[model samples]
Target: MVTTNKEKDLYKKLSIQVSLNGLSFCILNRKDNKICYFKKVDFEKQLDPIKVLSKIELLYEQEEQLNQPVDEVALLFNNALFSLVPENLFDEDNAASYLKFNTRILKTDFIAFDKIGQDTVNVYIPYANITNYFFDRYGEFEYRHSLSVLIESFLSLPKETDTPKVYLHVHKNYYELVIIENGKLVFANSFEYDTKEDFLYYLLFTAEQSKLDPEKFELILLGKINKNSEEYKMAWEYIKNISFMGPFHPFTFEETAKPKEELSEYLLIKSL
Candidate 1:
């Protein structure tokens, strides 16, 4: 097929990040290098995949932007059902086995994997029903575990120091902890928490296990946290050098569609 100038001018991309707790999406106009639309919806409580799909369907029916055709679609599944394996040690045929010991999976669950950089493989379970719905609607689309996108985005950053740096991507009830040293990923994991104390415990524990001193290592915050958030306050009590992840993207945002926090939707925007 030959490409046309008109088609090229209409180039746009949609990237969505979905989890049991909520869903967020953004539409980017590639020609202008701008994000024209962005929205996030949080559920009152955690929902199953079926319920989440229904919410997504309703959003598409109600939101004019979501109904518009786009040149590309990328869906990211964010959940705790993931495990990272070294690239050399990963086996495609036994993907399930790699996650079995860490994540609970049934025989009927669908498994998927995303190779990150040259050294890591992220193995996880995506919502089959959600994937099928997207296929029926968009024909062909790209999908990956949210952690894969997160890790890739972080790795793309320039290495500033040899000392290990800790990154925390906070969600509603859970958060992802990632440590990097000399521009390479050293540790990554997710933890569920109900209170600020639980969050602090996990953060400190992970820092200890990584042999990083809380008072010395730099901690960068991303996602749903802020200076006033309880999670931030608890972390500040121990960690000395803590800062929120800065605006690392160059894309312009539509004034009306801009997110309140620059670091909000770090993964969704980067996935584009």
Candidate 2:
């Protein structure tokens, strides 16, 4: 089949989301605003950076969709080593200082920040080796903290009420809690858990600390979670209102790449 330039341009934007627990990638046809490809790999257990890189290398060698040439690439790193700073007080020179209080950092570790709107900056650590690998392959690409994408996308949603709403983005072993009120970010934090009780504790604690009543406020779940999941069952026992987040972006998907759950790849699909 002869490939036209228009066809070549269709799948030019690639967005990847990586973490210790898993990795997901999405290929976007910008001209038509459609997702041409999407795939996700979940590790049995959290792997170290080196092992993660190896997995990524193996994936590139095996996944034909990833081999396509692209005009733009975006990498979103998901990890606990991140902090949000008010834009006015953020200093680029002291990026490490902002994270040191909450996250342990090595002297040799590289730091990066994503400017979220005009009011906040997300400071975190990106895997240097993995980034270098992408650099070698794509020449140049954009990368950001996964929280930045989540925050930005959630903030873009239309406000339904003035009451504070809790958004829980669940992962394999961790979850991000974001509370927004009247379309503004009220609080955001990531919590790690090993049991359903731990998950409930964090959710309730966050609500209490934020002075949001679990019975009154709406709780929207995203990522790898559903009503049937243990986490959801546990949350439902205490939290009176709970629901899953739906797709807010306009991008459509090819049948082969369409996600079974529209909310499953929330961060990766929105990263583009």
Please report the candidate that would top TM-score against the real structure: 1
Tens-digit lDDT string for candidate 2 (93-208): 98999998988898879999998877989999999999999988877678889999899888988887887889999888789999888887889999999999999999999899
Residue 191 Cα positional deviation in candidate 1, in Å, after optimal superposition: 0.6
Model 1 stretches with alpha carbons more than 4 Å out: 1-9
lDDT of 2: 0.88
Candidate number achieving the greatest lDDT relative to the actual structure: 1
Q: Candidate 1, after superposition: displacement of residue 196 in Å?
A: 0.8
TM-score of 1: 0.95
Candidate 2 clashes between residue pairs 3 or more apart in a chain or in different chains: none
